[model samples]
Target: MSELPLNPRSPLLPDRHPEPDFFVADIFDATPKGDQASMEHPLFTLATKPDMESQEYRHGDIFVNIGPSPIGRATVHDRDILIYCISQMMARINEGRKVSRTMRFNPHDLMVVTNRDVSGRGYLNFKQALKRLQGTQIETNIQMGGKEQWNVFSLIADATIVRETRDGRMQEVEITLSNWLFDAIEAKGRDLLTLHRDYFRLRKPLERRLYEIARKHCGHQKSFRIGLQRLQEKAGSQSSIYEFRRLISKIVSDNASHQHIPEYDFAFDGDFLDIYRREEGGALPSPAKRGLIVSDSARERAKKHAKGWDIYALEAEWRDWVTSKAIEVQNADAHFVTFAKQRGPYKR
Candidate 1:
């Protein structure tokens, strides 16, 4: 409950030992569990950074600024820990088991779940990630419980190393996740999206961020397109537009050469960039194959209705919002404009 760090770091007791569990077993399977799991919305920095420094982003009314900790700044890499945490909680929820924001778990379980090493350095890095997750700060107006206030909070409220290895390395840990994050999880997980297991293996932070944007907006559709400028903004990248474009261009080339990107393909045409979902036999799936086809001209009109907006992302949101309504939207452009007004713009 307090910001103070726990201490008395010591070796594990003679009786305390790691017990292999389902999560651990899942790691060794040919296909990792990450392929089937989904990451929460608010984690894994979408921007790439090379050092321990603060980051700020403002999209619509939501504002987030992640600060550093004593150990180091929480990088997009550190998000692997939180991803495993959310995956565990979601699994339990799907099984109809009672879950809580505060949890006690063996560190080995997390390492296995996230496809991380179990070495001594791995343990140290895991502990450091805990510090970063707890130390990183965020402030936003995303309406937690329908209230509006300006307050700063960490991804995790507190953590304690409950058990350790023979050499004083942490073995088991307990953490209380911040209420801001927990509330998002509890409110029916529609906002979250699934990610491929190879997501952890991506070498570059930008690559991971691009995958998240694609997975978030593309879903299982044939493809989704966005302007390069908006992609840079959504990524929260501090790089110059020219440099960012160069980086994306390399990814496009790599995707064509080695097919290194996971579950999706990227290509550039004029000012627009498209991320197409890859099917089983290296073929791009078409919307027509899925029995949903829209004329190219209609999509162009939707984009014209909202300047500097992503039509694909908006379309997905509109579809979800109107799915439960008795009357479907007759005028797509009008509904989209209303959605655009509600979200406003991202002002840095």
Candidate 2:
């Protein structure tokens, strides 16, 4: 195989310029205030309960705040979450710590660029990341990142609605180094790709599809349909698609332990994300929830509700807290060790 080159098309510009091909994206979520987990982001859809431990986002897991006119700004929570991670990286990198290069810019954060800097981990409004860079010399944390790093914080947004062009009036968008990630984006983009923003924004449902597909092949299924079918089988004969989706939702939310919330102990990815690392990035998906627990409160709530979401509500609180404080983790603190595992000191 030929060794691939870096930034073949260069996603970042010298000093930032108007990109005619890109458009700004802003997300809005319709789920009622009481509908979702605060940290999960409004766009996250319902997942099959069975697949959550596997990180399989399910269909309808996310009720995005978008179109037909739309709801509140699409939940840019994921984007904001990533942005917080970026800033934390920036602070740590500036302070001489190395963070992980394998980072996921929260998909929910794709939204209208309101300000350069975005605060809180709720979401990443491209406009907000820019706002974050104003006082600092860097663009988003990604803009200041290196070859091995994802500069997801740096986006190349364009106008979504094209006025004088051929494709009717509509929004279009792009990221800074998409040309470089043509492959990863293509494979991952299929889950929830939006041409409108020139970025990869996977709604909760889309993520579910990707997870299903990933589960089927684990590494070999090339046909998307066949792979999808295999995912269905994993749900078992008793599980309907809907039931499966809700099950997965329950797993993703409760994966982490927050007993350390106020007293968050020094931990590492090995502690919580441990299950994920148990296998290679690909392998067969687990047949059942790895280590999920249904609490008495959750079991009681389940009797009254058709689906389990309050479980998500509890996780959302920590999810939000993680995002909100991610940026601050860069600061020299007593708690930076555990939280900074992904975005912390690098071996180099």
Candidate 3:
């Protein structure tokens, strides 16, 4: 297998918090969940540097126009803030607790969970990310949480630095999410998909965007295929078809060698791209057994939930239970992990 090409400009960040107990806070336990709308569309820029260009995208009747601020359009990396907020809100909802559009959190906690640097520079970059997120204006007809409306709004309504350290770094920060985004989070399972924690570790901007596409579209299925051209559009890449193909080829080669991409594997063949769920133990069932493909990552997580029990056995039981109950598993991996956790340790 060919080795991953060196990325001099934006190398992948090391896992800063590898130990599970690094975060003792309950909020850190919330699974990362991304809004489906932005994932489905090219709402954020993939540029590593400031991008001042305004872009428009149209798919069928859906239209999205994004304009950058003086600093630049929000990049995919900046989207981390939104993901963190959404995850927190979702956890509150799951607990049957009321949630508000405005959220306040410690900057350090956000940086740690997102696998970002905790240095002074990291905090500064984080504040800049907030600015890009708040300044970038978007006008869209995309319906979020089942509400279809033509509205022009920024990704965030406003962001305030509630408190700052003596050195002037933000300490406590408050962000007011736009109604469009909050509504999507309010819709719960309809507009959000759980993301792999390692998502923050991906180095390249294109790599992150590709993973989102795979997570959103392939989702819980054994595999998904898309034409190369269609994928470029979905990724919101500004590269020419030939250039895009070259970039994708590099990513496929890198993934093939290191298996760095979480959950899904990528393959490029001629004019199409195939995304497969990373499998272990045995072959994935044909047609994914009612679209319930469990990834190896999920299985490992399940082990924590049902200690001393064979995960495969628990999986069989979970599948049987779902079938018996005629339950439609929307997020199969999450549902299965939850089932295992609820099953608890095996009893003699």
Best by TM-score: 3
Per-residue lDDT of candidate 3, residues 1-348 (tens digit):
232223322234688866535553676789999999889899999888899999999999999999998899999999999999999999889999999999999888888888888899999899899899999999999999999889899999999999997899887999999999999888876888999988999988899988999999999899999998889988989998877877787677456435577888765754788998887656333224454556667889999979976565456557657766878877777888999989998788
Candidate 3 C-alpha error for residue 285, in Å: 18
The candidate scoring highest on lDDT is: 3
Candidate 1 vs candidate 3: the TM-score winner is 3
Task: Estimate candidate 2's RMSD in Å.
Answer: 23.1
lDDT of 2 by residue, 108-227 (tens): 233222122223332334433333222111111111112334332112221122122252212232223222222222232222212111122223333333333233223233322222
lDDT of 3 at 6: 30
Clashes of 3: 0
If the candidates were sorted by their lDDT against the true structure, best first, what order would they fall in? Answer: 3, 1, 2
TM-score of 3: 0.77
Q: Per-residue CA lDDT of candidate 1, range 1-348, in tens? A: 222112221111121223446656643332322221112133345434334666666666666566767655666778787667666776777778878998888887777656577788888878877888888777655555344666678878999999887898786889887787666557545444556767766777777777877887787998999998888777656688867776776566445434566788776742668988888796633222321222335546665555554444444444435543533444544555566566555334
* lDDT (Cα, 0-100) at 132 in candidate 2: 26
Model 1 pairs whose backbones collide: none
Worst 10 residues of 1 by lDDT: 4-13
The residue-level lDDT of candidate 3 at 318 comes to 72
Winner on TM-score between 2 and 3 is 3
TM match of model 2 to true structure: 0.21
